[model samples]
Target: MKKITIQEIAKLSGVSVSTVSRVINNSPSVSAAKRKKIQAIIDEHNYTPSVFARGMVNKQTKNIGVILPDISNPYFISLITQIQKFALDYMFSTILFNTMLAEPNNKNSKHPLTEEDYLKIILEKQVDGLLILGGEIDKEVVSKDYINALNQLNREIPVVVIGSKIPELNCLFIERNLKKGITTLVSHLTALDHKNIGFIGGEAGVKITSYRLESFKAAMASYNHSVNEDWIVLSDYYTADGYAAMTKLLENNTTLPTALVAINDNVAIGAIRAINDAKLSCPEDIAIVSCDQFMNGDYQTPRLTSMDQHNEYLGKMALLQLISAINGQVEPMIINHNPELIIRESCGSKL
Candidate 1:
């Protein structure tokens, strides 16, 4: 059987090979009608593009490398899905790496992978660029060694950090004001006439934990409500850790708050489960709020009232920044997204 190529397909369709290639790659430069025509002809002829030939002509593997701390977490998974949607539209493919930064013994470690392992894979593949989503970048301050390693990598390939530490090396950065998300969640709880509020945050020392905890405290204090230290549950950024933290808060013997604010949707959902196990209903016994709303949150019994971080938008923006950096059109840039509160049944009805 003869394997038809792009040239043969283009010739049969009476169009330029570039047009056929654009249609195969889904490049926006091709007209919709032309793309449909090319795709039909390719389908009829059973033509396939040579991956080697495409790479040789474009000087691109059409591959992006994503290094994330945890792929199982809903927040990260949702982001990956959105990135795929946009990347596919542009005819790009992705390679994923779970850079297990969370330690095995650590209850909070969402990633059981390592930085060195991912770095090695990225280098070996010679990917077009890197999209780093977690681990050291979430730190308030990155270590010298980590910075040095990233700097060395950036010398060869463009790197983009999403919701991670800003490296000294010029790299595109996409992050949310995580503190704002916490504040918005907490503020909504406070407005519900809940004077006594509890906070469940990530591990005490990680960058995300510190930023969110401080914001929670500030927001509570601003409303003239003193946070009982016992009411605050600090643990790792996982559902099990959130459950443990909430259990600790429940056992603390402090006056239970009327509402609760959780670090992220995972923790919030865990806390919700714990509340149910305790025979309590949210907003009836205790109201609840959390950040990083995913589709799963919508189907919950009460549906979560969450802070929308515009994750899909972030994914698209990150790609734009990364491509520009790769083309040397601009230096590394930082883009900060503000958090917005989405009202739902979890938080008490507007008073």
Candidate 2:
């Protein structure tokens, strides 16, 4: 069988090439009857528009590059899953690059790529847009090299960063309100008479950790409660880190805080493990609340009370913002998403 070009498809369907293109793009301008005819022919001959072929015409690969710190994380997994699902509606595909900046457990992994290297790869592939979920962009003090690479990338294509905004870098930013989430959780615990609440997990140097920790202090002060210097434990963002941090906290402080605010669900789960190891019961002995919700927070031993980041919604919005920027909507959009606190048994709010 001979290859059918877009022209041949248009001729076969009794339409112009542009009309066929419109149908292929799911454009509403095409008449319903013409769309049906073109679609049926598309299905019958299994005629699919090639991304490269379309790119030659419109200079768009219909592809987006997503750079995140770790793929093993449940939050990133769910986020990418949602982004991939929603990208279908826009007839777009995503290419993923994990920077592994969040303490990856993969001892046998691919050659690590710097943020610049990943940016270079994305540019070489000629992706139409870019979405950065986490990594150096979330650092307490971003490096000059990382900033320069991002500056170059922004000049080349539409870029969206789903973290704190760097004023110097001109890109669309979708900032998550980690501070508000912490404030809400702290208030929740305080309302339950948890005055001596300590914070666990997340490295102290990371910008995200600072955001949550600073908010914890502010929230405590707002309620006229003093923070115990001994109860504050800073560790990396992982289960093992959380476990070790909590164990150390348990050991160093004979008198522990009545409750704890975890960096995230994964860390919260780790702290709970440590609690059990110490032969102490969660909620009964120490109430726990997670700053960010994960996939399995509900199934944990006592179930986790967490701040829902709405990853699905965030994923969708990130793609939409990128698309808008790709379409020349270059007015630097900043979206602030406040996390919602989902009450569960972990915090023992009911009790």
Candidate 3:
């Protein structure tokens, strides 16, 4: 829809431009009688005031800077889509920076600018706030330089991280309940009469990998099952990484885990292919469960039985948190998002 000028709106509402501006900004100086009339005209016309004009009063550009590790990853894609949708509700725009550091297929490609480099750009752009997902902040031990950069940035603008909560910086954090998802998957496999379970994918040293692995072990121990160290493989987050890891497990050991929990859907698909290439069937041979669910999970050969981290909901909550921070409604804090188990053929649940 075309946006009409504020002057046109004021003229239509039979009020001065300053009166309309005051009404748009919710200035208490405007009388209720005029405020109600102007508001009704705004509602009827669906008029959205310009951010530049609003900035003069609120000192906000109304643009949010969204920084994520990779755009190629389905998880970030799903999450960012929701962020953009909700930002518009408050007349805010999102400026996305795809760092491309975690792109599975483009590992060999080189990018000159690091995440901090993008932070400088974001500052220059003068965004109202920052929403960061899965980058240096997701490391178990984030670099001092990165932490310094983030702290400096936070001093200027509110920063929200959709990952781990760093003690060094007082940035607000929104994290997934990694233990619940992992424990729930293990419980499902155990209930299905599967005793031996293994894990695949996810590189070590990353905060997410550590969280999932810890939860996987704890979950298995909870059910009186021992974790097989040999079957547990730590690799990158990619289809090829999963294929290679699974193949290594299949080749080296005749004794295998009855069930496997993958790091993500990409790894699960690769593991399934490796299982198939070895002349084995999913569920019938080695039931698979994925930690992360993607958009195309249902279309896989055997639909993925995975943990739905509710990325969309996470994204929405992140935006809301950022909005709250922008409005000075919150301080540095953490919100834990709950993940759900989505069952499908891959886990032998359908069979």
User: How many backbone clashes does every candidate have?
Assistant: 6, 0, 0
Which pairs of residues collide in candidate 3? none
For model 3, how does the per-residue alpha-carbon lDDT over 1-351 read when each residue is reduced to its tens digit?
A: 668778887898788989999888678999898899888888988887767878777788999999988798888888999899989877899999987753432567685666777889999999999999887788787878788998999999999988767789878888778889999999999989999999999989898899999999999999999988998999988999999989999998889888999999999999999999999999799999999998899999889999998887888889999999999977644555788899999989854
- lDDT for 171 (candidate 2): 85
Cα shift from native, residue 51, model 2 (Å): 3.4
- The predicted structure with the larger lDDT, 1 or 2, is 2
Cα lDDT computed for each candidate against the true fold: 0.78, 0.88, 0.88
Worst 10 residues of 2 by lDDT: 101-110
Compute each candidate's TM-score over C-alphas. 0.82, 0.90, 0.89
As a whole number from 0 to 100, the lDDT of residue 227 in candidate 1 is 84
